[model samples]
Target chain A: MTEVTEPAIETVTIDVVLSALADPVRLTFVRALDAAGDWTCGSDVLRETGVTIGKSTLSHHIKVLRDAGLIRTRVDGIRRLVTLRYDEVEQRFPGLLAMLREHGPARARGISSPYTSG
Target chain B: MTEVTEPAIETVTIDVVLSALADPVRLTFVRALDAAGDWTCGSDVLRETGVTIGKSTLSHHIKVLRDAGLIRTRVDGIRRLVTLRYDEVEQRFPGLLAMLREHGPARARGISSPYTSG
Candidate 1:
């Protein structure tokens, strides 16, 4: 099992975090991760969020999220597990996750989502 | 007096807003505007926030913020008055301004601010 590395709570900056989440795909992914506990870099999340993208695109979004310290990804044998650093991010920048939960990407974009519309 | 123009609350997107505020300088400017209310596109805000930048750069940042719908800028005779779209942003994306208020750019960057230190 590989180690999970992310920015420390104290070292996390709002700018980096917001920049990471500025993408619509990443925002959808983060909100999905927030709603659900942990997800794998698989087609399940894609189907769940109704996001149509290739494997490379998903990988890029995952990398961006992890690099920004918003998500934690660790290799578990052959599978890569991903989880949102919800509490830690909230500690560093309060009200951020709560806002994401309350006002999701769908609402922000003025469009309904598969996750919310259902 | 020039008319104030901005993206309507319904048309405002989180990605644009986040992208605009992702810049450290712009984040500082928004926070300053939030705390101090209306400010001008002049030297006073530069002195208040301790951000040293040329007029063109400030104007550029102001344009980005305005284009992102995070702020409303209007011309009052010779002065270009700028104000944070605090309530409008809150209405569009709740908890964002509150988060900025609780975790300012200084705190987000893990630095002490002249405004807060004093």
Candidate 2:
């Protein structure tokens, strides 16, 4: 479909992607999205990610991820949906997203697990 | 050796580390420090990284990286020396530092190689 095009992935840098995933709340969003298949709605994202960030902050977070090309969004009816550009990301910097998925939150909280409080 | 104590790696979080690296200037500093082994003087760091960030800004970047526990600093006579806490970091989060060393700068500038312009 000519309605959408995947970014070349080359235009996206690891810094932006990494920084996008660097935040605790954003990582939560990424994790929730990762567990979700393709095309999750904004409301679902909020519910699944369990983020309490204000509406504007949520909007900002979405913008940061979109601006970094880490995700692409589309409108369906009255809802905006998002999906990860993991394939393009993997091509851009191999193992980047996978590492983030597996280790990002553990690393971010400064501990591998909640029970292992630092 | 009662002069300084290394931070317990467990206290460091990946968010701080990732965000610290998410900056271009700081990544350059990290790259320079990674290559520098155990001890590089502050002057050598600025010279080696070729960063034009002013004194206080440089201090701030160093603090960001240091606070993240990615590096350690010590005073030697008239100069302060900086070193990567690679072993500690590796233990805290495996493959994290190595990946950063190999792919950090390339990802930050949004290009893997300077020769390949975006």
Which candidate ranks first by TM-score, i.e. highest? Answer: 1
Cα distance off (Å), candidate 1, residue A6: 1.8
What is the per-residue lDDT of model 1 for residues A9-115, given as tens digits with 9 covering 90 to 100?
77766777877887788888898888776655545677777789998989888888887888888787777878888778877777778777766565444345544
lDDT of 2 by residue, A1-118 (tens): 3233435577766667777877877877776667575888756677544457677888788878888888888877766788888787666666666666656465343333222111
Separate DockQ for every predicted complex: 0.50, 0.33
Count of backbone collisions in candidate 1: 0
Candidate 1: which stretches are off by over 4 Å?
A42-60, A106-118, B106-118
TM-score of chain A of each: 0.80, 0.77
lDDT of 1: 0.76
The lDDT leader among the candidates is: 1
Model 2's number of clashes is: 0
DockQ of 2: 0.33
Error of 2 at B80 (Å): 1.6
Fold similarity of candidate 1's chain A to the true chain A, as a TM-score: 0.80
Q: Write the per-residue lDDT of candidate 2 for residues B1-118, one digit (tens) a residue.
A: 5254545787777667788888878877877777666687755677555568788888788778888888888889866788888888777767666666656465344333332121
